[model samples]
Target: MTIQVLPEQLINQIAAGEVVERPATVVKELVENSLDAGACAIEVELEAGGLNLIRVRDDGGGIARDQLALALTRHATSKISLLDDLERVASFGFRGEALPSILSVSRLALTSRREIDQHGWKVAGSGLLDDGSPQPAAHPPGTTIEVRDLFFNTPARRKFMKAEGTEFRHVDQALRRLALTRFDLRLRLSHNGRRSFELAQAEGDTARAARIAAVCGDEFLANAVTIDEQRLGLRLWGWVALPSFGRAQADLQFLYVNGRNVRDKLLAHALRRAYHDVMHSQRHPAFVLFLELDPARVDVNVHPQKTEVRFRDASVVHDFLFGAVHQLLRRIRPEPGQHHRVEFEAPAFSTPDPVQSSVPLSYGRNVSTPSWPVREASGASGSAWPLYRAGFAEPEMPAALNATEDAPLGRAIAQIRGVFVLAENRHGLVLVDAHAAHERVLYERLKLQLAADGIASQRLLLPEVIRVGGAEADQLEAQFESLRRFGLILDRAGPESITVRAVPALLIKADLAALLRTLCGGADDAESAEHFNEALDAQHRILADIACRAAIKANRRLTVPEMDALLRDMEQTPNAGQCNHGRPTWVQIDADALDRLFLRGR
Candidate 1:
């Protein structure tokens, strides 16, 4: 083949392959252009899931009559003029490829009139036309881009589109990402001739929350916590759902960098680490967060779609994000009446079966029946019953109990079947899963103790020799020192085997051989070091299991004082809102809800 220069039409069509992947990509590009044009009110109209037609109208500083044709020319942009300008580009459409690329693959008509112009001008183009001349059109002091027959010139790309609903959903999601950051702008979206949503300009915090509720859902807003923090020349503000509000998919996680929606892995990793201890496995936390920093400090040109960014100081950003979210989650206490508002509904418990019944509920070894203190017919403790034999001694009530109205968890009133603690405060009633609450308390305390005193090593009476692959043995030898941090000591017995000398004192009862094999199976490369850290994380989970075993279990009868002690401990402990498994430990039922249940007001 002879060397030849590609025509302008083919070059644009090729660029479209990178810039316009689907209808959603077109919507994202056009909407971003409208935003960059300083549009306060934008309307997006779609037909056939944006495949047949997509019209975006905006009231902003429109293009000039002479510049209308330039807008459809490749590499023509007004956002940046010099190399230094690209380094600190802030606008969403700085690349200048969106318009030309989209125009190449679709039938596009750009009509605009600047505020100073008396009449608007229209310019239409397709892949066959390089730069169609602008002609006189109706009056409008803004821009309206009408794109029809998307990917019409490229049959291969058009055939790859999904079903109508699926494609529309992607477009809706793209609009939502832009909507979350620009609360001051009014955005209206319509699909298949029917209006889908119309978000008005939100001016206050309450209205902004309403906008978020409209986009994410009322459930998210009901369960979310508001965050506002500024530090180190960075500002992060948004709402993060509580750990109990976790979702099975990460679809609801929206992160905006400097007002541009992005899905950077660095941010995701930070969020994962922050929620690691509290969130359930395979569950994702839902959040709508906005991060703002100096534009020069971040690079948005790393990806074709500008959906990922590279930070100059990723470590600093990671630490800042983790610390901010971690601190907030740690101090999260259950709010009054929060349980009844959203998805945090309390689990209903039925009354326990009669103690004298012939069939006693068997919960296996994990649960034990509590020995009730022996009492005389007069209801006084018998002289033969020793206090120490009761399992727990009652502590003196603090003076804080005098003001029960101000108590966060109220005051414990009764124990239900040794599994639940029922209490009352200003917020009507509070029900607590006694076992789950105790488990979290013990786990937190154990972690703290471990951190303070370091991992305690328990020597094995007999060294266990485990066989493994050559790579596994090599990894075991290489990661010996790192393994020591988890109190796991290993020796290379041979090319295919390793000897385990000791394990964490807390995991003495665990199957050491099985755990070592699991650890060895995860070591494959340098990144596999993270797997080693995760193995150590497994040790903490084992510790959690131990705490669960030691915690007070179901069918354990507790006196009022003992219940009060547990409640006080829960009130003081950090991250006490949810258990280790991400289940809420306690729920508050407001007095109004209780009244509604009984029709007391009526």
Candidate 2:
């Protein structure tokens, strides 16, 4: 058979397959066009989950009466014209296929009237190349695209559509995704007859949070932290929920490039890596992040739907996003007055390790660690409170000096249940998980020791041999040098076995076989360099195990002075808000919360 050009209608329908999948895609494309047209307000009405009807009305720059026919023509886009324009296209809908492609499959009616026109014009069609001309219609200084009986002409495509309720949910999600990107635009949606949502134009952070709560939920808003970081020609600003508030699935995660909503893998990987240390393996971090950069730096024409993009320097963007989010989660310490709120700083590209860099976690008068008055104790466990080992505990305090200011986390008053430490701060009552806090403190110290002179390698009495898969042995062979940095030396004894010659001096007491299994847990899959760096810099799960064992055990008796000393150590530790497993080490319950608990005011 000889190749031949397909019919114009068929060609449009085929192109539509790439962008228009179901009612959701149709809603998304129409709304994207409205946004590019500079619409300040958009109202979308759906019938039968947008299969029977999808009407989108936008108060934007309406098309000219003469160009009404051209609007139904393929490749006629007002967003871009030249190669240069295509390279750095800023608008959402640039390919101009959304209108004609939808027209070929559905009964489409376009109505518009510019500000200068006396009345609006309407053109109706159910085909790509409609010969009908625009007719005089009622007045309106905006544009409206009414798509009726979507896929009515294409029965085969319509057959693949999901159930009515499922399709409507998808359409609702599409509208909300767009609404999140543009807070200035008042986007409203209606299903069947009743209103689904009418999002007002939000201005301030409070309004933004309200809108987010409306779209996501109130639970997300309560635990969300607003972030705004600008660095090296890129700015990322939005809300990221705490790790504790993370979800089982990534449904609530919304990301936007510039102003257009997108789902890029590079962006996803960067954000996931940022949450690697804090969140569990099965949990997904919930975030609404927007990354902004020069238009020339990103290409939005990677697909007809414009949902994925190609960055000029993907590594740079990845590092910027990862560093910003990673560092912010670490600095989530309590601030004066605002107890749970997090303050954002322009994150530097290089996220420095607090122990190695200039975080100043010294045991001297450099910044003066708080000195708590010690009460005399006579128990045998008194000596056990301060663990003595390699890379543990500095010299005892240089006498007690009164703190000049009331610390964010005030002095510890008592220890209860042998598991929690109760402290009295200016911000009411503060409860801390004693074991979790101590684990974090020891973890940071371990990292500091590893970074300084390298953890001393402890040789086993008889080199313990552990079995493994052939692939695991191959990877172990390649990563020997990196593993040695953490004082781990391995040898491939056979095709499916590995011999461990030495272990980290700090982890000598840990079960060596279990530690080896945990380190090589997911080493089979091919990972990116960033992921490799994460694994190499800190294979934290193993370190966390060591820290857990070395931490102040629960049910261990402690005097007031021993507890107070632990509290001071927590204040100086980085990422001290959470333990290595991402569970929060401490929580704040202010006076108001306490009052409400007892119904005092009521």
Determine which window of 10 residues in candidate 2 has minimal summed lDDT.
364-373
Candidate 1, residues 484-599, lDDT tens digits: the string is: 75567889999999988987664555666667665655555555455455454655665565556556778888776667667777766667778887877887766655655445
RMSD of 2: 10.9
In model 2, the clashing pairs are: none
Stretches > 4 Å off in candidate 2: 335-405, 457-484, 488-508, 520-538
Task: Give me the displacement of residue 276 in model 2, in angstroms.
Answer: 1.5
Residue 404 of model 1: what lDDT?
A: 50
Whole-model Cα lDDT of every candidate shown, in order: 0.77, 0.76
Q: What local lDDT does model 2 show for residue 568?
A: 67
Residue 564 CA displacement from its true place in model 1, Å: 1.3
- Model 2, 267-354: lDDT tens digits are 9999988887677678888888899999999999887788899999999999999999887776665442433422222233455667
